[model samples]
Target: MNIQTTLKLCSVAALAVALSACVRVSTDSGDNAAAQADAAAETLQDAAAGAEPADAFLARLARHCGQAFEGRIIANEPRSPEPHAFEGKTLVMHVRGCDDPTRELRVPFHVGDNHSRTWILTRTDSGLRLKHDHRLEDGSDDPTTMYGGDTATAGTAQRQEFPVDQASIDTFNARDGLSVSVTNVWAMEIDPGQRFLYELSRPQDDLNPQGRLFQVEFDLTRPVDLPPTPWGY
Candidate 1:
């Protein structure tokens, strides 16, 4: 009977030890599973953040969005006035479309109170491009206009602008009467004291029936004192 009792006690101890080992294994498995779930959730969140193409482009555009800048127009082809000048013209850019950005964002400009224009910029594999998306008063692409000209002749190292394509021309006109092209870009610079500057030349032949040559200097710096609205009211 003593031998039997000793054997029985040993058996009971073994079973208890085995049960504890199983419990430990189960707890470890639960912890690992929880950790894996958390990792997967984080991965999913990262994907969601990058899914929107517009958001990415908007983030890029916002970097240069809110700053006030003066626009200078250069006419490659001159028509009337010997040369047209936009030196004294005033314009404003209101960038409020970031709420829901797209691959392209259209922001409106108000000349104090005159509905000036809507500039649309799009993201492309090459770089950021102006949509040149415009509509005619009749909502059509004017058959007589060209969106942009070829920039390949400028220089290989200078990728400031791309060659204009025929496809882009009809797309903007048919969808909207407005389309624009960057003819030439020169002297792009920015100052740490909140100033940005660039020179742009546009072919006025597209807009006016008679060719026009024009260029204007841009003040990219923020406005300190915009003149009061034209004294009409």
Candidate 2:
């Protein structure tokens, strides 16, 4: 072969090698980018799985904001001798006062024409808090108002238990005939689109030999008309 021809062949060979290297580098970069994207997605999934249960519970309950549900007493064990106040009364729950639902939610519980009770759920630094807000028809706070407790454990998203806190125990002690409530343990459960439950229980003791068990279930499938604004809003 001629010298110029040989030189041209060598140039072509080097050019081909350089082009192949460029192609390989481009493919490797694309593969690396895809791997990083996959890793990022997996990290996000793991984070969601490890989220706090109390936070998940709050998020689930917030879905019912601005809605009302009808409820009935499902169980009242060791039944009262006389007709209980909840007997033959219409029960309704209005999920309202949700300016920032994740932070706080107020649920008004209406019985017949009475609008004196509200259940306040709040997300605190540690976990969730449940407070009973009782008021009179005149919009005045009841002597037994603001009595409830806080979640002591990392309950599930569907259920949470609130054992009577020291504050609530103090309130019960101050009130006459309310000493039996010192052992109260309140619980709430939700099955999204199905049912919601509010429960109260107390262990057997001298004051309450039979203890206490009361539960009310609300149907979430069918929301009722909004009830009147609760007393003391």
Candidate 3:
């Protein structure tokens, strides 16, 4: 072959090789990006599928951490023989103690000037647990403290019901005039940016045929000023 022809052929061959390399690199990069996207999608789907209802409920409640809400007694039924402490009282709930929100949340339930009650929600291996930590003015535990229960089922993200556990039942049995609370079923509901509900119910029984129901609803749309720290922390 002539030198000029050989040189021209060599140039053409180099150009073709360069074009091939560029096409291959572009295709490889696109394939890698697609693979990465698919992996991320799968990971999200898996996480969603594995998530439990209690997890979603906790997450929803955690959104209100560091805030406070005003509540009112919506229903106090059956009319207790004695006067109710919540009647004509200003109710406030402070959501705090959320350093490890995924595991625990402490919400102080203030009635008028009383800061003796706290609702503690904790995550468990099986589901979630709710405990009423009652304290005296001097930061001492009350005789009827820690009287709540764990969730019995996989409730919705907006609500969870806790049936009185054996420990609470025993506590009730040990106290006078508290036997009526042995069959209590407490439920908490949250509608983000709308409202929250705390409910207590008892089925009809021989001791009290009328049963019982008490519910307090909080307005989440307007966060109130942070209340005092709960007694006994």
Best by TM-score: 2
lDDT of 1: 0.43
C-alpha lDDT of candidate 2 relative to the true structure: 0.87
Q: Please, what is the TM-score per model?
A: 0.39, 0.79, 0.78
Compared with the true structure, what per-residue lDDT tens digits does model 1 show for residues 1-233?
A: 69999999999999999999878767755645554454455446435675343333344335445444444444334444554433345555444345445555554443444442444555555444543333444445434332433232322111224344566556545664445432233322222223333234444455544433333333433443333222111
Pitting candidate 1 against candidate 3, the one with the higher lDDT is 3
Residue 164's lDDT within candidate 3 is 100
* Candidate 3 lDDT, 133-223, residue by residue in tens: 9999999999899999999898877789999999999999999999989999999998666678999999999866999899999988778
Please list the residue runs of candidate 2 whose C-alpha ends up more than 4 Å from where it truly belongs after superposition: 1-49
- Estimate, for each residue in 78-172, the C-alpha lDDT of model 2 and write its tens digit: 98789889889999998897899878989999999989999999998888999999999889999998989999998877789999999999999
- Scored by CA lDDT, what does every candidate get? 0.43, 0.87, 0.88
Model 1 ranges off by over 4 Å? 1-61, 64-67, 71-87, 100-116, 135-159, 168-217, 224-233
- Is candidate 2 or 3 superior in lDDT? 3
As for candidate 3, its clashing pairs are: none
Model 3 alpha-carbon drift over 4 Å, by segment:
1-50
